[model samples]
Target chain A: MSKAERKAEVVDLKDRAAARQERLPVLKTYKLFIDGKFPRSESERYYALTSANGESIANVQLGSRKDFRNAVVAARKAFPGWAGRTAYNRGQILYRMAEMLEGRRAQFIEELETLGASRSEAETETAMAVDRLIYYAGWADKFQQVFSSVNPVASSHFNFSMLEPTGVAALLAPEDSGLLGLISVVAPAVAGGNSVVVLASHSKPLAAITFSEVLHTSDLPAGVINILTGTRKELLKHFASHMDVNALVYCGSDAEEIRTVQLEAAENLKRVVIEENSDWQSEERQSPYTILATQEVKTTWHPIGL
Target chain B: MPRNNAALAVTLPPQFVPIDEVGIDERVSRFSKRSIKKSSKVQALKLALSMLDLTTLSAHDTPERVRQLCHKAKNLLETMPELPHVGAVCVYGPLVKVAKEVLKGTKIHIAAVSTAFPSGMAPLKTKLIETRQFVADGADEIDMVISRGKFFEGDYDYVADEIAAVKEACGKAHLKVILETGELNTLDNVRRASDIAMHAGADFIKTSTGKVQPAATPQVTLVMLEAIRDFYYATGKKIGMKPAGGIATAKQALHYLVMLRETLGEAWLTPDLFRFGASKLANDILMQLVKEQTGAYQSIDYFSME
Candidate 1:
């Protein structure tokens, strides 16, 4: 071809490339966070996410039951290391998570807004989620003190009951308050040293995926908190029935879902904590008692000197 | 007939067996993808369980710990009484008697690692004495480590001679020559060492000593299994295969079994012809078996920690 014709072809190609760059928006592929790494669903399946007004968002990973099983395995593998950490150290890490979340406030707010929340509501939810993390951070080192008791026994023995974190916990984040509800349930469980496999809010999962980024950077050990974005209806049964999960914490009070969780959990006799139709944004939601729900009471007796 | 025929020596010469690294990786990946579910999964798990040589080779291992491991090998999860006992209990030479004492009445053989174990750095005389002593102390199997240093130095004959000497010292006890493929560095070397060990009269060719990184990987295992198959084809002798270290999951154990069956056929799928030298693999197989039975995943807490 002639030099003039070649130059014209190059110019046309450059123009099309520029137009493509401007027209196509860069979208984040939401994936499951298991064992501290971001991986697509094991089944390689995805579901299209849409906003309240039918505006298309992006395709999110459709995690299968195998994903939940993998998360449980990760949580179980990380339980001993997480639970073995000093309570003060756990508190510091939880506080650091709050700090990381504060740094990502703008990102979370934008995600919430894209999910159909108003600017002010997104701001409030992000702030409340950060504050909720701080609330649990403070409770991390003090919950055992409040829950423990020196029992008075009739025998010549010294008896006392102390609180220990339950093993692996499976959590279902509330469908409404995506960010706040997730932090409310997760912060408490991790603060008490229970590693968790959480199913993020089905309708508002953008903030949850972004929140996992905050957790990734906060020195919280991997597998201590695994988050999966998928339909809760499909995953809740496996989450509750997994024998490796020592505790099941369901944030929503849907009668049918609660019944399924309770029934499946009976197979392993797991500790089931149901928060029915609870307002995660309420002041009552942030407390030490939330941390205590995933803890077990260990009573020990020391024989006195005769 | 003599275990090591004169013709075997001619075929066992250490020569370059060029390995296709890409081909091995591709073949090994397929083993893990096979869906052995339901009754097949349960059968594979039980078969894997029966092939386990539950091992504890730590410096911290004591007589009490050996006794505990032997007990676990004999009675894996008392709640599941129908489960078959493991193939053997593997321990240090000094601990073999301790394990033998606990596994007295059971079919579980006591396999002892000798010849300086993880590091075959001792003299030939020392290795023979260790092997003979363990055999005299009631060990039914002797897992001897081949000299990796000599093998790397192009001293193929020395490596073969050492394995032969150790095999002679083992007398009637089956000899499992540990190639410790982790240090061997290449699939070609793994195949070469496997060929050398088998020719040197290794009744069983093992992958690791449970003390090295990158042990018993699928690629290395496939190479070793292929070597064993070629050797069997040439000599009409079935040499057992043990991919020992780093095989801690039930799924991985199943994968190894699949590779073995596909490579060497079902004739080698027995405790007499195959073994898994692992401490954690037994419980995982038990957990999988329990899951298959109850239709629920199991917790490690429900099983004993050996």
Candidate 2:
């Protein structure tokens, strides 16, 4: 080909590439995670949150009280089926979720970019979240073995001990972590056969709800995980005080709020897990022991027949 | 007893020659000859590695190989108690408070890289605000990089003023002006940057952001240290020095220390006078210390970097 003809061909290729770039899909708005499905917010009260550099990257719904009620209802419904599943079965399901999450990593990366994370930060956080899911998934079946035992009684009685999940849990994910914190807390609780209601990060909730969609598509039973995106103060106090919530896991830096939640959780004698403001990277991976922390050891003794 | 300033002058080897005496043409030709032969891929990796601050390693590195490295360097620092402490355990900014708490009552000051470190591309007001926030959070020192674009465009006055304003904003906290030597291009410009920052009231002159190619190198550090020495002679005040970026192994840190010892003498060897702004160096130093004290090499797997 002549030089001009070759140049013309290159320009055509460039145009095609530009067109492809322009056709990239924009992110969704106003999402909710409930009953293993990502549903649009009941009301369209969406608002945009800007990054430190003043770029509007994420759209969050001002989740209402009705949204919280629906989420709790869904989680409450999911509790029986999920909690009744055998530990081995739950472990397999969680591992499958991790596999699915790993496959869609680029989607999460784009979501993270929309949430204003630097390229490195977005990749690391997403990878860590997936790794965390796998880490906790491996713990599902092992927790009972690690935390329970068959007891030797003084009398001729059969005694065995086993750890049981705390029914339903409520969590406030960390603001800075976006999807990572949301998934980290939710995955561990669900992997242990407990249902959860999580309040997504206020500023960056898109990724959390998108992750919820992932969970929805996974083989996970409905109502096992419910996510709401809103202000922490508005949702957290209610979750903390909810008598139905058997435990509360709060990922936040504010000392005073943590203290108040710890105190309020006492009302139901609820189990409270607090992750102090820290590099999540430094946190020990969740294991069977982690499940034991939120579970109760149940022991039963049977009298020997004469 | 009066301190002798002459003792602080760095000694050169008999064969060592000044760059000026060697001539710019010769230096450029020599640099090109050495640089061009390397594969672009290898150079990219070297450049990428050079850009990493490695601060996160200080918090989470636990491989036995890594621990051994830390142990070695820690021991050396302990033995040379007279040497200045390494710069703050430069962790993620949130860890600034943790470092402060950990290093409490110790003479070792806490330093945090703020103002969107590695690149001061953020707004000046935002940078100042961040500096103030870090200081408020108990950081004793702040290290910030100059606007590379401004410096490259011969806008030295703007760069100098920015450093001065940051110095003023620092209040009681010390400010370390990072020259980002790899991007500075010429020794003359590097020298000029040192003078500008010193005149602008920088408490110390730092070498790199650990986020730029060719960050902190012996050659670059040697040039900056000489500039600091010269500035000290011209002005009565002595400025501190920090060579950050890609300093992982104990040997590299020791080499830098040796450079400091030979150039600035024992006076500049203290934590107050000098610091190795690194994440991995501390652990490597600690590992060496452990080996020295225990008389056995311990598996590094047991210890978390934090």
lDDT per model, in order?
0.88, 0.70
DockQ of each: 0.67, 0.00
lDDT of 1 by residue, B163-254 (tens): 87787788899999999998999888998898988888999999998778988888988898888888877889999988888888998988
Residue-level lDDT tens digits of model 2 in A1-306: 999999999999999999998897775565777776667677667667787679766577777655776677677778889989988889888888888889899989987887678898899988988888888888888867877888988988889898888888888888878877777778778877899888888877778877876787678898888888878876666677665678898887688898779777776678999877446665664445556656877898977865
Per-candidate alpha-carbon RMSD to the true structure: 4.0, 22.6
Candidate 1 docking DockQ: 0.67
Q: Each model's TM-score? A: 0.89, 0.45
Q: Could you list the iRMS of every candidate?
A: 0.8, 22.6
TM-score, predicted candidate 2 vs. hidden true structure? 0.45
Q: Which whole-number lDDT from 0 to 100 does residue A23 have in model 2?
A: 90
Off by over 4 Å in 2: A1-25, B1-306
After TM-score superposition, the amount by which residue A71's alpha carbon in candidate 2 deviates from its true location, in angstroms, is 0.9
Which candidate gets the maximum DockQ versus the true structure? 1
Q: What TM-score, to 2 decimal places, does chain A of model 2 have?
A: 0.86
Candidate 2: deviation at residue B218, Å? 83
